[model samples]
Target: MNETRREYIKRINIVLDFIENNLDTKLSLEYLSKKAHYSAYHFHRVFLTLVNESLNEYVNRKRIERIAAILLVKPNSSLKNLAYKYGFNSDNSFSRAFKKYYGISPTKFKSEGKELLSKIGIEPFSSEKYICSIDNIKQWTKMNAQITIKELPELKLASISNIGNFEKAGSMFQKLMEWGHQKRVLDTSNFKAITIYRDNPNITQTSKVRFSACVTISENINTDGEINQHNLKKGIYSIGHFEIKAEEISKAWKSMSIWVIENGYEFRDGDYFEMYHNDHKTHPEQKFIIDICIPLQKTENIKLGEINNLDLSKYKDNLDYHQLISYMKELRLFFQKEYDTIFKLGKIYQGAPNFSYFSLTTDELKKQKLKFVIILNHKELYFSICLSGQNKSIRKKYWKIFKGSDWNKYHLAESIDNSLSIIDQTILKNPDFNNKRNLTERIEKESLKFINDIKNILE
Candidate 1:
């Protein structure tokens, strides 16, 4: 695509993100045009041409879709409240819009929840999928990319934004690298090429999608012309790593989304982007090794069924250190298996034999890590999750922010002198170590909760 088209995609994408994030608020042509850096008349004409919908129509349709998704999840939720939440002025107006968009009243759509989604061509994913035999999802993701959750650190980036084909990202990356090398800031060891996606392909035309090609930069840099600074906040991300030909990128993303929904995660409103890990030319098949990062949140009010058939009949009260060591290895292996099953791949930390914890990096840029630990002492078992191994100075910088935040849902780590390490509800006490099945279940459930709680604070 041409440079002009790229700029248009970049700007319109910013507007698209603004609209999605502020769905409950009133949006005006004047404000949106300002955001796009275009005259109101020109912005209106361009938006209609590129998006194939007038500003009002596009916003209203998105609002209606949001309501439909929510109504299906919360059937008893007040319709008037839901309408008002999505910017409807009155019940009559919301009802009219709902019918026009979905060909049914809000009340009727709620009653026929999954049916409503089918009629509107919306993919249906409910809490039931979370409980269904994991066979389908396991098969779906098995041959595809593996998915894992990690905490990303805040990044200082030098970026060039453009609208158009994603293939144009190469030019942007090249520009940043050239500039960085001239300024003596492009260190090969730590260099990273990333793309910040601004629009949803499902919602916006592919030709009009906006992307910001960015490279990690040293702290505080000056820029001129179209080069801009974007600070990416630290948070938890569901990362899908793929090594595939360019044509298969869309399938990789679809697999990532499917994994999230099937596993009962709600899409968090944030940037969706890709991080390129290797040069495509190096691969024999010319496949790109990229990590597709999507922000995610575990669904609220989800009730999981108990594994009643779990057998915990075997009990051994006493064992030699050799036997104890064998059990610890089994424990580590169990967690590794579970983590691999859910996250695709992760770095497991078994630093100490008595207490081995899996460490997930909070931010690769800052070298920070979150630790999930399992401790066993004969008849007793304990699980602890916390943040640790962060640079002390960096922890000092974020200490006030952590201190000012809520800690009701998490346990502050007891051993770490620095305040960065956090424990999850403290060590679980007296878990049935003899019952491996039940113990694994608790570890699986609690570990996820730990990850989620820490994400809330970091994000």
Candidate 2:
């Protein structure tokens, strides 16, 4: 891509984002040209060349499709309100435009939109209909996937934005991998190829829906022309790990969506993506191994985003988190088997993809309503332990005591109102995992020291 083309794509991307987000408002060539810093006529030509559609044509299609989506969800929803809300002048005008796209009037579309959508080769995801047939979805998911709720860590990514033509993604990923190898910033220990959906295909016109092909980066690399750099938000998600044929990808996503709704989880507005594992081309039956991740609202009592206690940057590394998780499981078993009499160890909690931990409490500490947590933060590639109470009130009481005291032996919480730990200590950083036994011995020494020191303080 040349400099002029790059600038054109970048500017057009901004305008597209704005137009998609604000379709209910007046969008004129002059107003949109201002957004692109181009003259109205020049912007018109640029949009036509890049998008292969006139600005008005693109806008009108989007509005009509959005109305189509609404009708699918609410067959009785007022077409006049929806059509006018999306910038149509009147009922007759909206009908003409809607018919141009769907080949049927808006009123007819409200009744037969699903069939119309299927004819256009677009799969519809209707929330209203999905709710009615959730039991089958649940059964399908149970037979095909192992689903769980997880908190994914913030990830640094280099991505290429693509519109509609998803078949081109394979080539896009190839280009990205080549670029990553050239930069020497690929996390080779743990490789991740992600496809992020920027627009809901069910609501937006399939040809206009945007998706991005992304790869994980070990450093904060600068964006190159069409490739951009950004971070995936850290949040709660409903993750479904599946190994399915290429054709079943859409079914996997829809099933996951229905499962999230059926489980009482409110969807959070964020990235809905697929983290691909194996290339379908290499599979015997051409199957893609993937994890479908859907962002979700935090459960009550677990205050997400309220506490920024984890100094995430302090432990950033190129370590493969999945590999680190395997190590964590091994280490947990070592403690359980070797010190069974000395420690009552809890199972490793993997609710989050970026970190995992197990609880450790002695008989004496159990009476005190306290335990210690050994956490492996794969984002930082380090291990740390914290003192936590059995409940929120207990943790709060201990946190206040530490906050008031002059004990600087470890990192204390600034506030406990939303934090999980009272005080924490970093026991190890960037472990040399090649020699597993040596690494385990080192961790054992440091962890025991932190535990004894904290115990002495309390006693």
Candidate 3:
């Protein structure tokens, strides 16, 4: 029987995944059709209608893609053995199928197929030349990333699919948020944006890759639109946490893959996805804190390590009010030192021991008494570029420009908007004064960036 659009997509994906993983085994029409819960006669027609490829053609293409990737990485392996290993009946048949798909003999592909293989999206970086890039691997490891393997629970997601470029997923996410709001289930505690990657970039052409922008939902909710319900299978996953700019995402993925390979983990044939922790728009550097999860083969011999032991001990929650005041003193001193070094202005405005205020006076706006404020509290610690003083009218005049300008670019304070503004970046969640110098550098860099952004906006 033919399935609904959602069912067809879901069942076909299961079959596709099975096909990719079991290319070395027999995958007869009856078997695949039964697995997809369809009668063989209707299954063939349904598969062709949805995937636009005959069952045999689609299976052969994926097998060829997989073989191409393996050959690129293992150029020294026997061609005949490789062909047989991937379920080819004979050398002649394999050669014909390979040639038909790639327009080149396997021998020619191994000898001079780098460009051709890349054109078909089968560029395996495990090739001898790339494997020797020890420096790149070292740099990646130095990111101090702590990767762990864990059993992930199956997630039922409300997802919107996007074909081709993954950049289009942003719009999908926005639409999902709008949908969640309309349904009155948009609480932040449970709601989270996720991206499901459906194709291996190493084997599939990027422009033909499929993905879905999804949000975790408690159960299958009613949806009559393009947004459909999907389930992420529960399995062992190697998750890598990353804090990086958007452009560094591809590098992060590569690094994670390398880490997995180095740590002796085999990748499972299933969906890979990313779950975001913070909004990039709110980050001062526009960096995303994302957890990249890769499904792994579940074997008895594999011993998994700690799953979520990210060394964030430098930020602790037991800070009392006295400790807060002490940490604020350190922050104030550091800010004063930085300002004095740059502008020769020493300890300009030290507000009660809990906060510090520094003045910024350019020739054009000296009367404005623009101050950069740093606040340390038991609950949270943050700093921002704001306006303070008795200059009420001047503050109001500039506040108008600040509000009307690209204020979103600045991290505006959420609670206090009148005299204080733009607390876009938090210096520390829980301060530890023992590592004061390092924390000082981080806050100083962020404070300067905030000042510069505000200056441009005001100008």
> Which candidate should be chosen as best, given TM-score against the real structure?
2
- Model 3 vs truth, CA RMSD: 11.6
> Root-mean-square deviation of each candidate, in angstroms?
18.3, 17.2, 11.6
Give lDDT for model 2: 0.79
* Maximum-lDDT candidate: 2
Q: What is the TM-score of each candidate against the true structure?
A: 0.50, 0.58, 0.56
lDDT of the candidates, in the order given: 0.64, 0.79, 0.66
lDDT of 1 by residue, 38-154 (tens): 999999988887667799898888788677756654578899998988888899999999888778898898887566654444435422323243455445444445455666788
TM-score of 1: 0.50
- Which residue pairs does candidate 1 place in steric collision? 6-162, 6-163, 9-163, 147-343, 151-362, 153-363
Candidate 3 Cα deviation (angstroms), residue 77: 7.7
Better by TM-score, candidate 2 or 1: 2
Please list the residue runs of candidate 2 whose C-alpha ends up more than 4 Å from where it truly belongs after superposition: 1-3, 24-26, 74-81, 89-92, 124-136, 151-154, 181-191, 203-209, 218-223, 234-236, 264-269, 280-286, 296-459
Candidate 2 lDDT over 207-301, as tens digits, reads 77888899999889775766777578899987887778777677788888777656566777578899987777875346687989988878773
The alpha-carbon lDDT assigned to residue 114 of candidate 2 equals 80
Task: Decide which is better by lDDT, 1 or 3.
Answer: 3
Candidate 2, position 376, lDDT: 83
- Stretches of candidate 3 above 4 Å error? 1-52, 69-87, 103-116, 119-132, 144-146, 178-188, 220-228, 298-459
List clash counts for every candidate, in order: 6, 2, 4
lDDT of 3 by residue, 182-274 (tens): 776544567678998766666667775667798977656764346667778889888877767787676667677777777667777677899
